[model samples]
Target: MLPFSGNASPLPRNAGVALILALAAIVTASGLLLWLQARALHRGTSAYAALETEHLRVAAAETARAALYVLAADPDLSVDHPGEDWAQPLERDWPGGIHAWARVEDAAAYVDLNNLACSNQPGRPFSAILRNAFTACGHFEADAPVDALADYVDADTTGDYEAAFYRHADAPLLPPDRELWAPAELLHVHGFSPALFAPPAPAPDARHHRDELFGGDFRQATVLLPDAPDAPVPVNLNTATREALLAVAGIEHAATVRSAMSLRALHPFQSTTLLAAASPDLASTLEGAIDVKSAYYRVRATAEHDGRRRSILAYARRDPDGTVHLLQWLEGVS
Candidate 1:
């Protein structure tokens, strides 16, 4: 069987096959190593991106705090109006095309939901005032939800729904039976809905009748929660919109609110006593609901860098001693 004479042997062919297998193994191992290296690099880049975004967010938040401190130190903290330096928007440009900005607003301009209840019980005078405001703004059926909210916060079971109503739901829930720490907590209540709480969108027609009724889409109305549970929530005469003033004073006091607004434009009230003197009728009606100075403010800050964006929302308090303190901080999605 020794073909092509005795010179050819089978061992030579076996050796050649072994060489090809070794080469194939080497190629496969190289490809695997390359893939692993690429995956590691991708993970490192992602981590770095996240770190940079966090830095931007922190920088923006600090900028907001600094501005608030300056505002607190100002000589005249009696009034917070649209034309004030603190109310104006702030922006700054940084290295690597990064930019940061912040905006401050007086929290007293909005209605405090906690003020709706008196000593953990509902049906207080403030509740009726809010209902009247909602009705005047064309949301006539606001009683059920508002009452439900009051029941959810009060320390008793006197709301429109009982504990069984929530317990028997698809997902059982329980009320906190305490003051709400944030306005967004309303979403957890039985009757509260996002549509009712969210800011209204612009109407289809620019000149619509509902515009007048709803105070130009109700941009002036908002809900706020103070850091102090027992502190009185008073609407700031200098910062509150006419709609808010009317809401706190009731629809019947529309003429008085208009007059007060006009008077404040010419000369902002330096004290609550001055506001009372300016509108004796409104002063009598909204004795406990109105004020001339603001103790709380909301700050919104945003930062952008290398096509990435970060945002922060904060609730702050300016003490009577002219010190600013942060009550709550919220970090938003990019």
Candidate 2:
């Protein structure tokens, strides 16, 4: 016989086990809900961070462009290009509580791609410089190939310069190289070497400061030789090589001419001497045929964004009074 209690009952072992299982299930469900909520929050936070970084990058680019506009518009600014001592952060002004600064790079501060001093032949003296420019830009050529660009653009050429560009095996329908608007494109050319293109390393007692070098674009080795109005340097018809004469602006030849020796015999011509001494027929042919001056000049600008920094490349021309005009801009450089 067992005594029965009024307020108590004997529980089955199975019923007690059932109660414990129910409690365990609730605890696991609660934990899973919390984990899911935390994951959602982390994803939202990551997305917001990415969006903020992009906005900051765009702001940085705009800041650079605005500073460039200021440099171009200021009348009091000096005519000196970026490489000169005058180009500095003080040249620009920032607005709207935005912290901004800039560095002007002289395009001429580096080796000029247009300089035709390749084998030292007047016709092709710029080969080495071109090669160097290409080397500095290793990826450009393998991706986009242009074989004989310099030869095609100069004053005299036998045919269309673009014909020489080779097409990639992947896309033979398209030309390997594209048209170039700036000397920086040299880095995009094929067979260029980095060792040759990089500026000579800084010397222990370097007269030029690092700021000066970083602030400019690379320049071409060849500059327009001064020429008189009527007699400009006669790009030799018989002696000039095809590469040297191709980009001469106005010279037209029927076929590739070998003029290495002939060009050496001919002295550098100013318009005054060249026009008078050249055959009348030849002189008449080249009246507006040559560009006695070079159109390219280097430019640079810098800006700060999100506590980070960036640089830009610009090619430009300036009037005698320090007013600058844009030729090109390298955007979003870090």
lDDT of 1 by residue, 99-191 (tens): 888888888886677665556322226676667556555577877867766677667876665576678877788877777887678777765
Worst 10 residues of 1 by lDDT: 116-125
Model 1 stretches astray by more than 4 angstroms? 1-13, 117-124, 157-165, 199-201, 215-219, 272-279
lDDT of 1: 0.71
TM-score (C-alpha) between model 1 and the true structure: 0.84
Best-fitting candidate, scored by lDDT: 1
Where is model 2 poorest over a 10-residue stretch in terms of lDDT?
Answer: 221-230
What TM-score do all the candidates reach, one by one? 0.84, 0.43
List per-prediction Cα lDDT, in the order shown.
0.71, 0.40
